[model samples]
Target chain A: MNWLKYIGIFVMLLFLQVFLLDNLHWLGLVHPFIYLWAILMLPIELPRWLQMFIGAAIGMVMDLFTHAPGIHMAGCVMAAYLRPLMVAGYVQDIDRMKGAITITAIGMGNYLRLLAVLVVVHHTIVFMLEAFTFSHFGFTLLQIILSSLFSYALILMFEYLRKNT
Target chain B: MRNLLQLILRYSNFLLLLGLEVVAFVFVLRGNKYQQVAAAGAANVVTGSIQLMSDNIASYFRLRADNAQLLEENARLNAEILELLNGQTRKRDVNDTLSTRNREPLSSQEAPYIRADLDYSFIPARVIAFSEDRHHNYITLNKGSRDGVTPDMGVIGKDGIVGVVQSVSTHFSVVAPVIHEGIFISAMIRKNDYMATLHWHAPNTRRAALEDVARHVDVQLGDTIVTSGMSAIFPADVPVGIVSDVSLGEGDSYYDIDVALATDFNSLRTVHILNYTHRAELDSIQ
Candidate 1:
């Protein structure tokens, strides 16, 4: 994998997340977490520990901006820890791939399923921890489901655009 | 020892996950306990600087609307000045009659009480960041401690009260805006002088509730609400909002009134921090 390309993508995604998506509150329910694209697209061969560390770093930076420390970090690290299992289930030859992960390499259906799974896991954990209790369990679940759908659509659109261009 | 080493090696990834999760959990716990002030402050400084840059870019897009609002405020002030000037000629006669009607004569020691004057100075600031969608919304101002902005000072936009200053950094300060659930202001109905407490029900930016006004008060829709000046933070008669709805349930002693907030938090960009010079004196006496 070209490290420079990933670094460039990381920086771009971070700015996009902080400046654009983070500020958006669609009907006060859907907050698109598009920054996860960087973690989600890391080379499959990357070490598990390194992936977790990177995810933690990215999530902490996000937490810094959103004024909620550690929430994003915990969620992102959990997603990173589970990413290998998700990818392995879809892409059997991930080890032989020499480039960064792209939607075209895996079929769109598998790619979207992987994205949906990661986003659902991340949003569920993040929103649940944010609520901190089951007092408003239904509302929290609504937020998780709505935000996951919103984020998945956005990430899918972003991936499609990137793949085409 | 060999078995233990094998067990650790076999689940090293899980162990690392647990270790990272613990670190993250510590952050969550500290954040929940409000022990993460240093981190939050540092984050504020960094995000404030970035928000300032973004505000500079975004301000250009809002210049037309801001100019219109400024012009409207200026016109209102000019009209007020004209009214005061016109009332100056009749003021002496009114004062003479009022003094004669008084039960006691004016004394030199009591002269300060007769003269109406405000003790606050306004520090102009630009809002670099504002959020209304959250349960706890906050506004970040460009002015900070270096600029003589301190905590507990009142902030108002051109139209009405914004919030109270919560914290300050070297170059920035955070305001606990009126939209936040925790904020409450002592407000009154401008028509009948009935006092009430103004509070925001969470997740709503356009409206707030004026509580504790007795049911018998002649609270009507469209009545103006202004700060009662009971607290030293805001001076008397600053417009807070207008009554949008009034309701009472059977057996309830207090009327529930909804107010359409005067300051639109969504478009709020510039504000003035009210610095009451006599706040310390007032606090000491109290």
Candidate 2:
């Protein structure tokens, strides 16, 4: 594994997330968080434990920036824990699942499915835990659905941009 | 022990999920603003009924003190009556003054709705539970929406103003009292009509700071503070407290005056909830 490449992506994504995207809330309801790209870009060759460890580290950094401490950590860890299961579900041949999650590495259909599931799951947990109640179920659910779709679109764009990587 | 180790080894992934979620929820409960208030409100609702039972029994033992308070208020009202009879009190209106002056003493025949022309009315309520130890203290009233008690109405006791209704259920309502750090009471000194803010910053239950009183005003000892009636919630000129101490810091623009609160929260038994009739209209104007 190239440590330098991973570190570069981590720093760039975290900087964009904390300084830029955090302040840009569309329509005052949806917030597009692109920091999960760091997790999404992880290679399938990494062990499940290490993936989660990296995910938790990313989440902790996000939590430090957000001041709401455990919210991002919970979402990030769950996403990391579910990534491998999603990958296994998509890629039937075990030999093919050992590279970076790119459009070429995983076919277009499986890659979109993986992105949709992880982004929705991560956004759902984060928003639900932030509210900690179903009292305003309508507003919270709308926030989650819109945010998931928006973040999913942005993550797909990022994946397309780094296609040859 | 070997069986336990085998079980742990088999389900380590699930244990990790549980551990991570547990840590996350701990921080959420401890630090999240919404969760903390919701938890506090739910806890108050559960304990409110139990305390109501004990408060009923405990009030019987404190009747002597309560009676003394009522007697003091009665004497003060009687003195006001004598002043009004002597034509020496401040009058809000000439018609009101003339009617009050020519008013005959109540006899066996009196109107049932004497105060029908008044813009506001009071709902009698009992203080079921109150806590002064916490920074953001809350008082629970036995009256709720069922008895026409709603959120944002002012609560007052025999001696002074108490708090505003915060949340109301069917039969119970919680009050964010004057001692709570969140509420800022608008007050004016009776002598000079100097507007200042009453804030409960100091931990002392008996004292609160009268903030923003300009240094130019002569805020003497024993000066009376009352509501300014700038807000739609509270009425004008309701008694607040007395300025117990005043000290001006050198090269300061404001005097740091401390007020000795009139209503002792400890012996508080019953309170009246003020229902301002035109609150919605006043709020809409703003």
Candidate 3:
């Protein structure tokens, strides 16, 4: 039952991203990577290696769809590896927590911090690597900021809905 | 071996993180090369089928526009055929003399209509995927090796040049389009034949920068740009764009030019992938 629920969410997020959210790049300026929800809501107690593996796998799927090759994969792996640190920093008593990382799993203040940092980290790596140069650093920075905000907001809304429903 | 196994077990998490990142970065750095080794791996095959399905549903919306364009082309081709038939009756002797002088006797193996008289052939392909918003934009076509779409073949839309074929899979080919910074089209001013290299500067889809034209060249607004034919990919005089803006810095050796690309990439649906027969011949000399 547990595996079925997680897999269902994973498939749904990717399906939405590739078909709908991808085609709907907000105002043609920002791309909301809603698929990151799959990685974000992974079981908090999963082994570090397994989490990174799943992250890279999702990134690989996105890279294939977007024709980005390694850009998203690199971002995903880094985000997965660093997420534990961010979660630990926010909630000191993480051992008491179980199951997925959700708003209900942690308080709102801590949840927001965890989500914000991870989303920014993932977006920054993906965009910077896609740009591959600091020559147009300002433009790239603007993309990172706009895209991160859009992705962060979308993830927050999904998390909120999950907690309520 | 026992010590090494124990050490690996002790830091497996850190080791795996390092290992995965290394693999990811390899694709990042190597993906952009001409070979596009990372472009169509097994994963792309999975996504390619999904894109094909979506494209089928999406293509229905564009069917009316596609029909109109087809009708226009059909009308033009009919006119050309009618004129050719008229010319054949009126001046058969002249046509025979001029055409036979440069040609050998018709070979038995040749199918007259399949390959055009020119050195190039074209495979009609529909765009299955296109991305212009990204820095490294790629266009995926529905044709591939099975359809004879090899790398480096030129792709052109009804309006103008699109890009070169960069990678191929069984059923899909990826194009490194003119909108990408990595692609540089050798273009020339059609009026004066002044040549320049064209590259896409980020943040805009409709415009690209034309560089290396000397300041003294008689370039102007609305001047035509076309492929230079310096390379085998695209034939000479294929319309690239019309010059939209041209400016020269004071005492600068070259003109700063902007071209409104002929093809509206946002609405690109179909492209003709040019199969240049003599590409190998040209490559051998170099």
DockQ per candidate, 2 decimals: 0.48, 0.12, 0.60
The candidate maximizing TM-score is: 3
Q: Estimate each model's TM-score.
A: 0.81, 0.51, 0.89
Question: What lDDT would candidate 2 get against the real structure?
Answer: 0.74
Candidate 1: segments with Cα more than 4 A from true spot: A23-25, A91-99, A104-106, A127-143, B1-37, B89-116, B186-197, B211-223, B228-230, B246-257, B281-286
Question: What are the TM values for chain B, all candidates?
Answer: 0.77, 0.74, 0.84
- DockQ class, candidate 2: incorrect
Q: Which interface RMSD values do the candidates have, in the order shown?
A: 2.2, 13.6, 2.0
Which pairs of residues collide in candidate 1? none
Question: For residues B52-130, could you state the per-residue lDDT of candidate 1 as single tens digits?
Answer: 8888888898899989977876786666557656675577656755434432221211111211356676688989887
Which scores better on TM-score, 2 or 3? Answer: 3
Q: Each prediction's Cα lDDT score?
A: 0.79, 0.74, 0.81
lDDT: worst 10-residue window of model 2 chain A: A19-28
| True contact recovery of candidate 2 | 0.30
* lDDT, residue A71, candidate 3: 84
lDDT: the better of candidates 2 and 3: 3
Q: After aligning candidate 1 to the native by TM-score, how far in Å is the CA of B186 from where it should be?
A: 4.1
